[model samples]
Target chain A: MQKNIAQGNLIPFVSVQQMVALIDSLGVEAFMTELAGYIEEDFKQWSLFDKSPRFASHSEVGVIELMPTSNGKAFSFKYVNGHPGNTRHGLQTVTAFGVLADVDTGYPVLLSEMTLLTALRTAATSALMAKYLAPEGADTMAMIGNGSQSEFQALAFKAMLGIRSLRLYDIEPAASRKLQRNLQDRGFDIVVCDSAQAAVEGARIITTCTADKRNATILTEQMVGSGVYINAIGGDCPGKTELDPLLLHRARVFVEYEPQTRIEGEIQQLAADFPVTEMWRVISGQADGRRAQDELLVFDGVGFAVEDFSALRYVYEKLSDNQGYDKLDMIADPDDPRDLFGMYLRLAPSRKGEAA
Target chain B: MQKNIAQGNLIPFVSVQQMVALIDSLGVEAFMTELAGYIEEDFKQWSLFDKSPRFASHSEVGVIELMPTSNGKAFSFKYVNGHPGNTRHGLQTVTAFGVLADVDTGYPVLLSEMTLLTALRTAATSALMAKYLAPEGADTMAMIGNGSQSEFQALAFKAMLGIRSLRLYDIEPAASRKLQRNLQDRGFDIVVCDSAQAAVEGARIITTCTADKRNATILTEQMVGSGVYINAIGGDCPGKTELDPLLLHRARVFVEYEPQTRIEGEIQQLAADFPVTEMWRVISGQADGRRAQDELLVFDGVGFAVEDFSALRYVYEKLSDNQGYDKLDMIADPDDPRDLFGMYLRLAPSRKGEAA
Candidate 1:
């Protein structure tokens, strides 16, 4: 009876506004730090997850995708869209929302806006991977294509790895300026660089997050230095990548899920049989992470469903103390499950009164 | 500018309470009739749509599924779960929600509670198939399962095909009693029968919607009469079917989508190479329906995503006059397409004030 009462017809929904409030209340740096913990834990148990490459419906302009993964007890999926042309229309290039459901009863428990959460989780995953793949004592990061994701990446590194310096660069000068302005009071010593080459100079961690859909060389082989880690996030989806094929050939590559990364990540540029280590294997201690401090590690990140599942589980866990969500009457709950028709008929009179 | 304004970050959500209100305002019979028309229209243009077998995540207890389909202009996916044991926990055996998005933009235009809509669409689909496959002047339906979907099926037949009598039977007699009580004033002459054999004694349309996760014979070879349209609904997943294989062998089987029906519909009990007509071809006048007056016709209904798309599109159209929906701030919309961090920072202060 208690389970039934708790599992009422309502689902808890956290909107974009609530997501911003949650981050603001927790403070951005602290929130990213806590988020990295969840991502790290899920990565440690990565073998337990049911993973799949996202299902995508594509058009000339962009794609709408559903990324679903489950850890036996809980299932989560993110509905996300990406339109490079959307920027011209005053919209974010990407927007998303996600759901967490109970695997036991196959009922949804939480639904939340994931655009902001994605930024947070992507940053967290980047930093969590850096903790394993980046060279020891690497504090300065070169963030190329300083667009929407630049500040989160900056803050996540600062919180998770004590990265005290950020050198940012964007093709458009205005984007780098905006990144600097946003991270002004966030306690990072930020440097606005003239080009991607200038941004990577003297930095051990180089993050390339350009949003172009073309196969451009954001980071050529000559630009990547020995012992430096390359966090490649923009080369997601086929026909889009950041690092040069030569850089991938020279560096020891790591990935989220090899089967998916082969198709969507920067590794898409590599041969079908190209060798890559699954990051989960490293996190689970089933495989070695960095063979040497100067091994030239490449984390070809395209993002994965398990990270979203971890984020949703974290939000579901945190909702108990946060009142930033609203209850939605999303499920039809009749007193007798067999009498769904009777329930509708019973509500007819009341609806008529309201209409009148 | 108008396009940008119209494509705002808000998604319209029709909740369960609003769904019932919308149905009540329209009258259930009238609503089902209108819904059938939309389904028929979509089926006519079925060749223009992208179709795939639904993606399902299975568990010991039940399954959660994502059904996605798209036309060149619009896309839709339904998140649904089916748990036969849920009734014991006071939950509907099935609950669903769906999203419709612009194929050009990948942004969700509408989010609707699909539990009620699913029932409506499923019933409408059954009647729509019957219109093409049922024998002429068939006015009696033997509804073998009298649970959640029975009344909608009964009423759909009444409104669409002028079915004036219903021969109802269920393993649990109380379910049949509830169905009879609900249809008391719906202008149908209903008879409660003791067995599946007794129920189809004098009916032209026999619908079996029993919900069990195993192979069970709700209809045997001798029970199915000549010239009856069998709407099989319950055998919607792997290893779950209702009718005897002999009936399928003798009947001219019709299906929504051949690939999906082969795995989830009653056809799963038949041979992998069993012949089945695609229903859309018949609706479009490309195939024959009811080949002979005495020929057995089986419309193996496992449900498909296009029906949900049609239902969501219909609901999106009807929402213009109905104020029964809530606007969800489900998408992250930042002023500068590349300035997601700046947008969160801008909202940070307002959220802080609300939290305080």
Candidate 2:
């Protein structure tokens, strides 16, 4: 049982752009479809995982969190940060990286730039919920927040659910214009809306992805009609939320990991005993999904580690054939482990300079 | 305020041997003295820190963890792994790395290889504790667990406290021999003992750093004298402990952080209401250190994130003036801030296929 990272070997390190290209080459639709399958499968055997709520460190400016999860065979962890006011400083709201390792050996097999992968997985998770919760052939989606993550969600829906028409709205109209322009030749019909109300007017799915870190009610209970799937993406921290309490109460709420969702999801505003279904149950066929055509279902997305684990797995496979990764010498190897001092002297210059 | 990490455009990674060289260049004694002062300063404003117990992913072979801490001015984190069984695999039992960043900008100012730094920091912490807990003229110490970290613990005590004699013991005789051989010319009088009893005989301080992830009775209550200071290092993680519960009951235990120690330190064996003082309290003069010369003081060392934070800060200052570091485009810098997709086109072409 003496497992190891192996001698004279390197772990796969994928850059953000390399991963974006890898995922793009994999195709957003195919990736989303495959990613959903991995999430669905992991969720089915959920009892095998050792789970814990994310460990978060918050400051006045932003938050940095570490989310770790392990299935019996492998372990994964993501180091992520969210800074809502960051864009004002000319930085992205989120920046991240992660490592996946062998459960037995404790050697990182995949060290990846997860900034872009996070966007892919978040969108993938949303589309995954739509696959199980949306009505048959649901095509039109009203995207309320059109920022950096907007195009990702748009493309995921377009590729996975065959979403054809997108009615987009944002606090800044330029964001909507950018989303529309990016998908111009991609064959999806797009419409720019004046407000959130106009965006959700006749859409089958309404996605509220605003980046406000406050208790702002972007979607009222009345605004969210029946038979609509709402992907609430931006309200991920405490004191930050999107859906009105009434809307949360009315919708058939589904969550990735309940204890985490209770603290960081839209349900953070609600009572602890607030009834909600774990998404895995629905995907595993053990629980009902979209009970009625007019049932308003809320997929409260604070984002989860399992999705990132799947994303890491997805990109690891893609980097196998690509020629663009840097091999980092992260771990040390010695002929004799007990002679670390000797190893150090041989590897680095002597502690004493000159001929001493 | 939006803080950006893009302007400097340097990755600045430090390898283990490089960090050792950096510390050596700065003078080990001077570095240790400065680090101790920094640790003391941070401890004075301890309430401002957001601290938590490390998140560990454990398996039969080894354990990997993420230890994160943040003050208002800065954020720091360490990625470390321990596998006592790794000796057979030709790797050190503990391997680690970490990053220190500005709180406002969220940019990593230093990403260091802490495999050796961890050992350095741990020894520095112990030496700092010895300054407060050990009597004014402490001379000899029993160095239990003669592994990779032993020589470091030995040297730090020699450099910082002017300890003149040493006694070493390990389960593996060869390890003890290696430690003895390495420190032969290092100023301290080294003695290799056959048994733990032989090592602790007539010693002023007892340092138990055995690496078994079990409740091993490395030092029993009978083995410890009333006035002897105990530097308990290797007992970390939930079921892993070095001392017996009886020892904790008698010793005036000083922990790094109470919440974290309650889970991973010798205090884990105590009741939930167990009274233990944070080491920072003693450092800040808020709590008494060594009430009586005969009082037993235990530095229940699981290693704190804040110590790593201080260590990273010290090394960052040491290396900031140096010229050897690789600059990585780990962060996304979109010109429009709205068009992250546009940055890839501007990224550097493959340094590959270039005449290296």
Candidate 3:
């Protein structure tokens, strides 16, 4: 039987292929740059957002979390999972999808694959923080882990902060080689270092993103120089950290949301009352970013819902022309709202046969 | 450019059309009867599931909520919204979609439209409760507020408890007429009544399901008779209720989840320490369902996540043959888990041109 669904029932869905095609039309660097602009705009209006820590379900091997946020007019949420052991089974360590809905009508307007969007938004957030905290004219970065996020980090910095020199290190040499090969033609001076210390020798910005589900000090106190910016992104869950406790004492930490960062970011190793600055305050000019050239600034990044919200909003705005999305009939709409049963009756096989 | 995504990246999606087709093939009454079986199976093992109050974001006009539950091996969450004023705009007051994921790998395996599924599950849950609490050989039911859920409730009772007669009433007369017309060919002896009091006369079961976002009582203490089962399903949010305080005190209440029911169910009108039995205990025989023929039993159901979990599990199991689903490329997968950038680079327009 043929059925015609109402327009309100169709949700715009962006699949992985459509996401790739959209990014291809707009170069990756430009997309991140544009996405960063959206993040910045939302951060400027930070106080308007309703923020809460993600609801996470932990298992023996992994975690599934729902991060939700809204700004009175619109609501957005991301469903994400992190499983460090998934790579052994040929699966991504992180996978995500998100939805943007109108708060007034309580209807979802857009749905998109957020695995790639998460990577892009994470990198954009890192670069946005570095824009305020990094030293003057810093052009070199030390990437301590070369995994799924390494190339995005490099390109975002290049697009936002003009960082063109890189030093990379990973536990697996193949990972670093993979990163080099991916960025070979992206216009950068690259060096593959054997150790984290060697990677940070002359760089003014150091980014640590490792994939172990344990506490590992990839950067020690002595390895971090004065006046350098530290972007820590991989220590996102409890008991999963990447910085030395001593290093946190030396740096002035800034976080996306303090309540969440205290439990999931690098600062999870520190005391509950450890003082930190919220990045929104910095972006809104309520707090200082870098006080002195010799001062250390650490952006304790654990990823936040607002960043995903910004990414979802960006994709939703870009979907106006309907070029990068498919219409998904995901809602049940009857001619009369109270007649859902009548609608179903019309679709019944016996009813269809009778109508024929 | 053509890219081959791994099997793990594709999630099986059941759209509204597919859901209708699946129900048509199975027949609605049989479908709900089988779904009630699944709900019973899960309720029997209720202690093993992770239960949490739904996360709600309330606005002036509506509310959006996320209800999540898991049983160690699998996880499920439903995104639903409620807007009482949506009908005036030709929209459903309730719309939902859900996800089922494998906890072992933290990957979603199934996504389905849950608007229709929610109606079916709610009806199944009510009828499942009636199987234990309704007076013996109860064949007649009084259905108050014949909205989207009225026909489903009638059919589920017919399928599960052999209730062949229904007395329906609604403030909007058109709603009752619509429900009667929908179930006219389904072998039900239905009477569309003008008043709730008149509808409950001579009925052994009374079901109250209205769509007002207020504390208005649809059933009074004097109207309800002893030895009857009361299924309260629509008083499902804070500050919204359907039963009078006197009526709640007169009935022995059973709830899906006590902590949640105290906040969102008909019992929300009573004191915080009001006594209630959990339905799982009743189903497992830990608590008595109906002690005497004259004892009043009320199933104060403010739909729980476990019921939705059961529905998601049911659909996931039915998708094995892939007849009622579409493959959605919603995850980003790289040949090497760490080489997501390489995967994106291959999809670059310049790279596609070069390959050509």
Ranked by TM-score, the better of candidates 2 and 3 is: 3
lDDT of 1 by residue, B131-250 (tens): 888899988889988999999999999999999999999999999999998888889999999999999987999999986669999999988778788999988877889999998998
**B355 Cα displacement, candidate 3 (Å):** 6.3
**Shift in Å, residue A270, candidate 2:** 4.6
Task: Write down the lDDT that model 2 would get.
Answer: 0.77
Residue-level lDDT of model 3, residues B76-180, one tens digit each, is 999999888898988888899999888888888888999999999999999999998999988999999899999899999999999999999999998888888
Q: Listing every candidate in turn, what is its Cα RMSD in Å to the true structure after a full C-alpha superposition?
A: 2.8, 4.3, 3.6
Clashing pairs in 3: none
Report the error of model 3 at residue B280, Å.
0.1
Separate clash counts for every candidate:
1, 3, 0
Structural similarity to truth (TM-score) of each candidate: 0.96, 0.88, 0.96
Task: Grade the docking of candidate 1.
Answer: medium
Q: Write the per-residue lDDT of candidate 2 for residues B174-224, one digit (tens) a residue.
A: 888888887777787888898888998988788888777777888888887
Query: Which ten residues in a row are the worst by lDDT in model 1 chain B?
Result: B1-10
True-vs-predicted CA distance for residue B208, candidate 3, Å? 1.4
